[model samples]
Target: MASGNMTRQPSPPRVFVDVDVQRDFCDETGALYVKGSPNALFRRLTEHAVARGIPIVGSVDSHAWDAWEFGSNDMPAPEGGKPGFPDHCVKGTPGWLKVEGTLPPRFRFIPNVPHAPIDTAVRELATGQTHGVYFEKEVYSLFANSVAEGFLRELSAALGGAPEFVVYGVATDYCVRAAALGLVQRGYRTTLLTDAVAGITEAGVAAALGEMQAAGVALTTASAVLG
Candidate 1:
């Protein structure tokens, strides 16, 4: 039996996962803009995370100009028969960049590659050597990047356990929904900042919220999170 005086180790700080808050999705004039993106709220959330020294793990939709996912491309869809979306977030384009106030001063971009250095990433994230770590994804789901899961697993181990995740960003129906569901499926305690996200359509957002809630993702607002 353990001694009564023994103390339990403190849990790690909650992680803020910003999902695909790029200019194309947030800016009104950009391609594939999400309606009603709360740019001010996004800034506040990012600033709060940085000020509190919380780790920020985020995803960016980085596509090639001629990628199959672009509806302008003639290539066939990989799986479903559905056509692709309008060209958006093409690499090196203005719209591909992250929205203002969403990035930290000290952050690293991890490209989608077969041999990502997961160990190095975990160390940097867990030690606060990097305030934010952003993963590049070609598809709506960050999990589409093969290295993402491995990096996340190692980070969890380094942090002593799986940390609670607070998720936000553009397109509540697509990327944000995929991210929140992915986190919950991996047994992470996930929360979605409802007011901070926008969506392609009202119906989509409503359906996404229901799915997320059913999957054990807590839905709340930025104010609640900040408080």
Candidate 2:
């Protein structure tokens, strides 16, 4: 369903979108750790959201051992390749868990599977019973998940209007950048929390933040989130 079909109270003014805050990316000993813990701020955001009564939706990267992002793949064709990053967030592993202090009871998960029935998810979301969807992605952009744009459409409905997303998490240069840009492309307003996110390198983070600003994604700090 399109966003207009759902009936509900107007959503809270802010929507907290927590991107891959997984152990594999946020933990100190992770296979592909980002340099810091956004989870500490992420936890505060979750509690803040609850205080304001807003929803917190989290996205995770659930990949096969042979996912294109990994170097350990020994498979063939579409499923096997690498962009030169080390293996991380492999499916069915503890390393893939959301980092400590990030998975509060307020959050809802939408795992990245190869397939998700968008229409069904939309219907469920429209019922006003779900807090949020935990989208999963094999690709960097969460928008590339199996639910595709339908997730946003439904999410808008669930929130009772178009969403104004406050996004944070992981390496500032790659997945986080892709997700922020994707949200803009899909016609949503986005805000990136600087203090709550980390990067692979200082240069990379600066470049990514510059790019996001140029693309109209508001650059702000976690402290700025009043909720």
Candidate 3:
């Protein structure tokens, strides 16, 4: 995906947190498809970003094959994965790749690998390659990544005042919920783009959204945020 004619980050530019819009979570053929999610809407959201020059912090889940999630080596369930969970997003595999068009070429990308020295998020944002920081996460929330606080701090210091992270993506009940609430907890005014995210279950989505609202996470739509 190319971000055509997209430049000039918005003043008090909005930080878009794209959480786990990966093949494994959005594709029916994937190992952990999120019930009814399709990548179609995410593609539209990507186009909206390119048109709006909104820098996106794209996050992906990268797991090593030996990760306990796969039940490899008799290891207990991976820290973030559950027992009996099908092996998905294994490092260097197609399933590990971002969902189609979610990662525009102009966006910086990071794969959250386990035990990798240095925070991939900090390194990517520090490079200034793109206004957006795309990094990997080993856990459900970006905060679970070692450099999460640092990454948020970098954005805040660079942008002046804390950057408001406009978040969206798959599994609204889980990763999306965690990211939104975590951002709020970190003191960043976080907004969860309602329509941009999909969930594993309707009941779960409702519950998560309710919790996020109570936690002070602004629930809005992409149109409202991007406009």
Candidate 4:
């Protein structure tokens, strides 16, 4: 669908959020790593966001062993009982874990970090009047699927009635772009944090960025978020 901006609408408060930029997606050592994710640019973008107090949300692709995307009666499982099409982000595996030191220790430094979701990490601060909210988008856009919408609404309500969402992450052409577009359609001012994101392919990234621009989502860089 096409997107447009209406000039009369009052601008809302803005913050930075992202799709799956986890170890599984971004690190070469990870199971389902994207080729573009481990670059210095992505590190820089993530580092910059950590330095600022901007509320950062991340979408994680978590699934059980029997999910339809991986398991079907007709298809046999790959070696080690894993799927063949992609080898990553498996539930409870090290590859499924977030990258070490990607964000500051504070973000990941909980008593029980292994089971904690991103929402829990930011919930206390986000609930406070001055803090920005955080949420997770498991499937496509955080707003694309039903589960994500529940969390999105809770976060939105916490941050008052209106909020501007800036997005970044791995596989820019697909998940990241879709989430940003979804946010825009929901009447939020959306920005694409280009540098912080990586795509499966260069062409895919280029095309998605073009589509996002055409849709009236502002294209922004991590540097802009940092400074």
Q: Against the true structure, what is each candidate's TM-score?
A: 0.92, 0.83, 0.84, 0.70
Best by lDDT: 1
lDDT of each: 0.85, 0.73, 0.73, 0.59
| Candidate 3 per-residue lDDT over residues 1-227, each given as its tens digit | 22356465667767778888888988888988987674777777776766666657767887777766564456675354456567888867998888877776555554454444434444444334454565677667877766556667766665566677888888899889988998898788888888888897889999999999999998788777656
Q: What are the runs in model 1 whose C-alpha is more than 4 Å off?
A: 1-12
Better of 2 and 4 by TM-score: 2
Model 2 is weakest, by summed lDDT over 10 consecutive residues, at 1-10
Clashes per candidate, residues 3 or more apart or on different chains: 0, 3, 1, 0
Give the candidates in order of TM-score, highest first. Answer: 1, 3, 2, 4
The window of 10 residues in a row where model 3 has the poorest summed lDDT is 120-129
- The lDDT ranking, best first, is 1, 3, 2, 4
lDDT of candidate 2 over 9-128, digit per residue (tens): 344546678888899998889988887766778778766664454556567888887776666664444644446568888878988888776665533455555565665555444453
Shift in Å, residue 64, candidate 4:
1.4
Please write out the lDDT profile of model 1 over residues 1-227, one tens digit for every residue.
Answer: 21233232236658889999899989999898888989988888887776666778999999888878777878777786745788999989999998998888778888988888777777877777777899999877878888888888888777778788889997889999999999999998999998888898889999999999999999889999787
CA lDDT for candidate 3: 0.73
Off by over 4 Å in 4: 1-12, 38-52, 71-84, 103-123, 127-138, 144-147
Better of 1 and 4 by lDDT: 1
Q: Give the TM-score of candidate 1.
A: 0.92
